[model samples]
Each structure stands twice: as structure tokens, then as C-alpha cells.
Target: MSALWTIFRRDLTLLLFGAPGRGGALLPLLFFLAVAMLYPFAVGPDAKLLARTGAGVIWVAALLAAILPLDRLVEPDLEAGFFDQWALRGIAEEGVLSLRILAHWLSFGVPLMLAAPLAAGLLNLDGAQLWTVELGLLLGTPGLAAIGVTIAALTAGLRAGAALGGLLAIPLAVPLLIFGAGSLQPGGEGGLLLLAASSLAALAIAPFAAGGAIRAGRE
Candidate 1:
């Protein structure tokens, strides 16, 4: 219990504030904002068009922001022999990764949810649409975090793993993107339900898959 708590705290700190060679929540937050800010300039000042497309834009920005932290998630720890140390101490990799998924969501997902309102405004979303966007993100970001950690573990020791992680994650996250953005539509409650199901499925599988990847990498 103590060791898991310690590791959780460590992962959360590294993810939120960053380490020497790793990115933190700030970079993703800034990148998300940048995309939201730039969209208006690119498409010109059409409020209806912005409002119509804004929720989807927010979904896309959140997805991209989720990717920014992939390089730092598991690779840095693997390179530092942190996983080996945990294994030597009799801590299960699955346990550690389960905690890591929580930490990753806290660092990556929550901030994106918090920032969604600002993105909503930039994209000219209405009050109702903003509410829906928030709800969709709440359900969807967990899956994004799970997928990010899983891919990070899978591609940890590979060449250009960061880029590969992005490629892998984008395809896997497509369901979340589709459902998340689709939920913003007026009769889209079904999309939200599907989004929740996808998130739960990812969360259920991520810990075991990521643990196996880490163990394989050590062999």
C-alpha cells in the first residue's frame, strides 16, 4: 500500500509538473489552448460556423493534447530502470500501471476537462453545447489516458517511439473521438453511452496490457 501510494504520488508529480527530460500537464494544456485560439483565425469570424463546428474542434484538440505527454509517460521510467526496481521490490507491474493510469488521468485528462470551457468560448460554443462537451470529455478522457499509457509501454524502447505512440494512439482513440464529438449533437445521448462503454473497456484492459509490455521489455 505504501509503495503504491509513493509511486502514485511520484507519477502524478512528474506528469503534472514535469521532470528534467519529460513533458508535464502544462505543455498539453498550452497546446490545447493554442489549437482553440488558432481555429478562429484560420476560418475567419463566422459565429454560427464556429459554434457549429466548435465542439468537434474541442474534441480534436483534447485528443491531440492527450498525445503530447506520451513520450514521457513510460519511456523515461523504463530508461531509468524504475520498472526493474519496482519488480525487484516484489511490486506487481499491473498494480503499478493501474496506479499510473490514475495518475496519468489526473495529470492529463483533468486539466483538459478544466480547459474545455476556455476552448468552448474560443470556438464559440453555446452554454448547452459546452455542458455536453464537458460531459463527453469527462467520460472520454479516461480512455484516452489508458490508451496513451498502453501505447507508451508498447513503444517504449523502439526508435522514434514517441511518433509511433501518436500513430498507434490516434487509431485506437478514434472511437472516443467519434463518440465524444458526436455526443455534442442535440439527440446524441446514445453517443455518450457508447463513449462511456469504450472508456470502461479501455480502462479494464490497460493495466494488464501495459504491465505485460513492461515485463516483455525487461526480458
Candidate 2:
């Protein structure tokens, strides 16, 4: 228990503040905000269009932001032999991965939610729309975190793991994107339910799958 807490603390700090070569939480936050800021310009000053499509833009930005940290998620630790060290100390890879997922969410997911208001303003979303976007992100970003970690683990040993991880994550994340953005529509409250279900399913499956990937990498 103590070791896990320590591990969690270490992970949260590294992910939040970043390491020497890693960009950490700030990269995703800035990227998300940048997308929001630039989107209005790209499409011109069409207020109606911005309001109508803003939520979906936010969802897309969040998805891209989630991808930014994938290379750092597992590869750094795996390359440093941290997984083997934890295993030698009787820690299960699944357990480490589970905590890592939580830590990863805290690092990027929570910040994105907090920053959503600012993003909403930039994209011209209304109060109600902003609320829905927040809720959708709350339910959806965990799934993104799980997917990111899983993909990171799977591709950690590959030559172009970072690029491949991004490709893999985008397709897998389509359901979340659909349901998340769909929730912004008038009759789309049900999308929130599906979003939560997808997030939970990913949360449930990611640890074991990522753990197995780690073990496979060792062999």
C-alpha cells in the first residue's frame, strides 16, 4: 500500500510537472487551448457556426491533447527498467498500470476540465453547452487516458512507437469522440451514458492489457 502510494505520487509529479525531456501536463493544456483559440480564426467570424460546432471542436482538441502524453506515459519508465524494479519488489504490473491510469487522468483530464471554460469562451459556447462539454469530458477523458496508456505500453518497444501509438489511439477513440460530441446535441443526453460505459470499459480492461504488454516486452 505504501509503495503504491509512493509510486502514485512519483507518477503524478512526473506527469504533472514533467521530466527533463518530457512536456508533461502543460503541453496538453496549452495545445488544447491553442486549438480553441485558433479554430475561430480558421473558420472566420461566423458566430452561429462557432456556437454550433464549438463543442465538437473542444472534444477534438481534448482527444489530441490526450495523445500528446502517450510517449511519456509508459516508455520512459519501461526504458528505465522501473517496471522490472517494481516487479522485483513484488509489485504487480497491473496494479502499477491501474494507478498510472489514475495518475494520468489527474495530470491531463482534470486540467482539461478546468480549462474547458476558457476553451468554451474561445469557441463561443454557451453556459449550458459548456456544462455539457464539462460533463462529457469528465466521463470521456478517463477512457482516453486508459487508451493512451494501453497504446503506450503496446508500442513502447517499437521503433516509431510514439507515431504508431497516436494512430492506434485515434481509431480506438472514435466511439468516445462520437458519444462525447453527440452529447452536445439536443437529444443526446443518452450519449453521456454511453460515454460513461465506454470509459468504464476501458478503465476495466486497460490494466490487464497494458500489464501483459509490459511482460511481453520483457520477453
- Most accurate candidate by lDDT: 2
Compute the lDDT of residue 87 as modeled in candidate 1.
Answer: 96
lDDT of 2 by residue, 115-198 (tens): 999999998999999999999999999999999999999999799999999999999999999999999999999999999999
So what's the TM-score on candidate 2? 0.99
Task: Give candidate 2's error at residue 180 in angstroms.
Answer: 0.3
What TM-score would each prediction reach against the true structure?
0.98, 0.99
Taken over the whole model, the C-alpha lDDT of each candidate is 0.93, 0.96
Worst 10 residues of 2 by lDDT: 18-27
Question: Which candidate number has the best TM-score?
Answer: 2
Off by over 4 Å in 1: none
Query: What TM-score would you give candidate 1 relative to the actual structure?
Result: 0.98
Which pairs clash (backbone N, Cα, C closer than 3 Å) in model 1? Answer: none
